[model samples]
Target: MPFFLRTMMKVLRVPKRTIFIVVIAFVLGSASIAYAIEPTTFHTWFNALYWVMTTMATVGYGDYFAKTVRGKIFTLFIYVFGIGLLSLVIGKIIDLLSTVYKHWEAGKLNFHGKDHIILINWSKKAQYAIEEILSFSPSSHIVVIDESDKHPVTDRQEIHFISGDPSSEEILEKAMLKQAKAVIIFADTRIDEPALADGKTLLIASSIERLHPAIHTTVEITQEKNTKNFRHVHVNDFVLSYDAVSRLAVRAALQQGSSEIINQLIRREVGDDIYEIPVRPEWKTYKDAFQGALEYGATLLSDRGDLGINRKLNDPIPEDARLFVVSDEQTYRRLLAI
Candidate 1:
């Protein structure tokens, strides 16, 4: 064994896998330059590089070739050593890629983006949430973090995955919690009991709040009873999964088209979706707010934040009012601009 190769093997402890890559790169590069020196149809360095790539991919176009005896001899040399070595290098590189993909799907990789939403659990609901986010805010980045050994999203793009307990500071920091826009913690539906699932969800919410109380956290509680416990944390929104669904089902049973109406109100994929925008300064009362909403072609539904939703049209709008309008994303943005 060469001294450097032996030393590298001892130091890196990966055998010839790493050494072959470096050695093949150096050898192939040097050989191509030496063979392309004179009139061998390769006039420029770029042409020489093109020949090497085409030859490696087994796509010899014959646009460049060996004309002289010396160059022909070098071509023979290339077939024997160059092609074989290139094949080995390619195989090893592909193996490395497959290994990386496996790790990524297994939730072994850590997230590295900023201002992204972090999802704490993986379920069918998580998949739906991902699809909805992609539909509504296509530009937003999402990182799905789960403690389970299985990865939820491997084939998906524009979304990242991290496998670790969300409550741990190491994992939270890995997900870039300090730079996160929001953390959506989902209940463990596999737990079979709402309280048990909500308990675990609350624990994660508390851990996140403790790390950065300023972080906007939306938690899914399995049971309505768990809402009181979430008050301990600075959770910005709560999804009463079971309770809300059940109530919706009841309403749907009582009123015709109630389920479809409710679905349309919050649906993101098609039709008008619910949007929240700041009530501009000119909108001092509900009447003005309605007029402002009409100008933007959005129906004013409710007010959020330091304001009540079910108010008369003549009622005064609160200073810290956020209006929820029923319209497309463009209309909502237009209303905000007003």
Candidate 2:
């Protein structure tokens, strides 16, 4: 057996009850044999050994008896031993049952799906992001991977928590990296070396890309300078909190209802929204989709074809392109009807 198993067995092994039962069984068997051959010089110890094996194996032949006074005393002693042995056996069985139950519970929490969000670090911002994702899609499964023993998000049936260092390949594999929709690496702000934290996040992102090149990854960088180093990783999105916050503050002051508008726009699964949709062969230009959006009470934001590129809102659409449009489902359906 493995060392762990051996250790556990020693720690949780059955009690003295088992020994008592064995002794009792031996005594009873011996007594019975002694009684069967009454007046014969049959040794009690020899008869006990024979009887114990037979009884434990459930091979009673009914050829033995404990009719005499000495034999009866031996049988009484056997009963005591048997009871203790049974208790010990029962205790061991209970321990095994508990262990199996725990394993079953853990299995039920396994995550498997695409487009599902994987949050790397456990922090206030990450916690908020989780809440936002949940609010957008209540049925969406969010897996939190962190080294902390305790998770920040409250226990829920849908959320899966795996405690481990995010940078570890084993941990990432456990979180189902290849199958994940988007892996979001949150920089560990609690650490003194914020740049080192970002580096770790970058390494994790790069590892995922190398393992599964097609996988979409988004990373948060605490320092703006770190963003330049991450360019080689091909991360789909790079969110800089410092810059985004500063811009948001400026926009909120200049544009009335801009903060609320921005909040609704960024919030997933709510309000008049912009979402990516593949352009069909029939749709030739941005103008073609722009007209469709107008009819659907929506606006075409950008095209997936323009991803990783610097393009203006009014940029002409590529012939073979995918588009991002802002609209409600009713409007979306109507536009599709065109």
Candidate 3:
């Protein structure tokens, strides 16, 4: 059975008293005819039941008749009482059906499983972030939790959306927080109070941490100063939108193609881009990955352990590190000559 139907059945299950009343009414109404008519006429219980059904349905055929005066009176009671009971049953069924349908609609957007990203708050930037994540991992499942009535993205099976306050434990539980890989809280664009948005975000992060300490968390902040307050929450990453934009503007002023390069790096498309590959212990140094990248139409950017190559890179490939060019699997295989 469908979940909605099962729930409705549980809710609308007839009470013992109601069942007893209905049974009594049906039996009394049917037996009332016995007071006026002879039992010998119907010949069997099956025939009497058939007569009762036809009479209650108002589909009387002249084949069966109640000739006695008492039978006429019993027929009158059946006509009035039978119609009312039938209507009540129909109304209850309709009510149960409507309840089931509403639950079914809600169930469609419920999330499940672990290692999924949960995005709190809906905004243009959040939408862009989701698009970027999808571009890299096309099969990744995203659960969006927001208070908005409609989701910005078109309904796809891979994307689950729930409308509720992110700070609420009930809502977070519905988003499958325990199994989530990461939670990203977007700064609410409508709210002018940066503190309020950050508070909510922090509360959600704290709740997740309390429930599942190992889950990764990232939060977007409008003010750079508020970033310090979130340190205790053990947030994996924090994005100061205003500061980042200002820095980007400064860079764009000096470099003409800076913004384009950043865009291409974020979006997965045909381009030479930076990507992270897990280090294989057999590959002793970054130089091995560099030689591997030369064959694969890619460059070994840097090694995860090389602290010296953190941000400053004068050349495309860094020295003494292991970073592989990440493109399609075919390109990676061909480059490795595998």
Candidate 4:
């Protein structure tokens, strides 16, 4: 290659924005030159542009051609330089896509979306949580943070992963924790002792609370006794893994098929899952909310943490009431619409 051509090729490898602008300018300038030099043959700007593009791309459709000697020489100039520039652009695009994919697989990319759910630590339980979240809301964005080198789930577009220590504030920020809708810190099952696992979870929970106090946070702990420790950090909810399984097993043994019913309610893949509904102006008491939900083919389950809404059917609804109902997806949508 000539010195000028080599220098031009080097310039093409600059930042993407600059290369993009240069490509645009080159296409426009080449088209204008062709149109000015061969007005009789290249009748319009579009024709000249088409010819220049085809020549650069090496497509050479042969629909348009330069009739004059000067136009032919100019076309040759474009054939040599323009084709090289176009090749560089194509190569650059491929390189960029490869770089992005590597970053994604390595969990080195940062998530900037708001209202996304963040799951710290990757485990079988976290995998199930991702599935449930997707089933509940297919379009929901989820971010996974862990110390592992590779992302656990790369097939899902909605689930993003970041590789880092969960307790580190810097890693949490990379996951965009402050803008997240909720953060679920799962216990590191690799650790054998319950106290050690809960200790790790508590550290991560405290970091999240300090970074974004208002954001809802749910944590899984091995021991139920450590639940009180989370209260100091104002963690929103706790999932007692070991105790919950044991209690559910005992309940199932006492009442046949009771565990199955609970499973259906908790998992979105099954029937009549729990859902939250907005408080309407018409609702004055638990009776009003219950009847309204029933009319929409749903049953009001509870108000906030109070599961005894059945006992307080006649009592006035509190102003800060958050009503939960049991319904399928269609019924839930109808209730939300109202």
Winning candidate number (lDDT): 4
Candidate with maximal TM-score: 4
Q: Would you estimate the TM-scores of all the predictions?
A: 0.79, 0.65, 0.62, 0.88
**Measured by TM-score, how close is model 3 to the native structure?**
0.62
TM-score of 1: 0.79
The parts of candidate 3 lying over 4 Å away from their true place are 1-110, 149-154, 270-272, 304-307, 310-338
Q: List the residue pairs that clash in candidate 3.
A: 114-179, 286-321, 286-322, 296-335
Question: Model 4, 71: alpha-carbon shift in Å?
Answer: 2.5
Q: How close is candidate 4 to the true structure, as a TM-score?
A: 0.88
Q: Work out candidate 1's RMSD over C-alphas.
A: 4.7
lDDT of 2 by residue, 129-169 (tens): 88778875788888888777654555576667777767677
* Full candidate order by TM-score, most accurate first: 4, 1, 2, 3
lDDT of each: 0.78, 0.69, 0.71, 0.91
In angstroms, how far off is 138's CA in candidate 4?
1.1
Error at 93, model 2, angstroms: 9.1
Model 4 Cα lDDT, one tens digit per residue, 97-154 = 9999999999999998999999988999999999999988889999999999998987
lDDT of 4 at 268: 91
For candidate 1, write residues 1-338 as lDDT tens digits. 69988865554555546758665675668446645554346767667776666665668999887777777676666677666667766666787799888888777777777889888888998888888888877898998888787677766767888888888888888888999998898888678977788888888998999999999999998778768889877789998887888899999999979889789776787778888878677777888877778777988878774344446778888776777878987887776675
Q: Is candidate 1 or candidate 3 better by lDDT?
A: 1
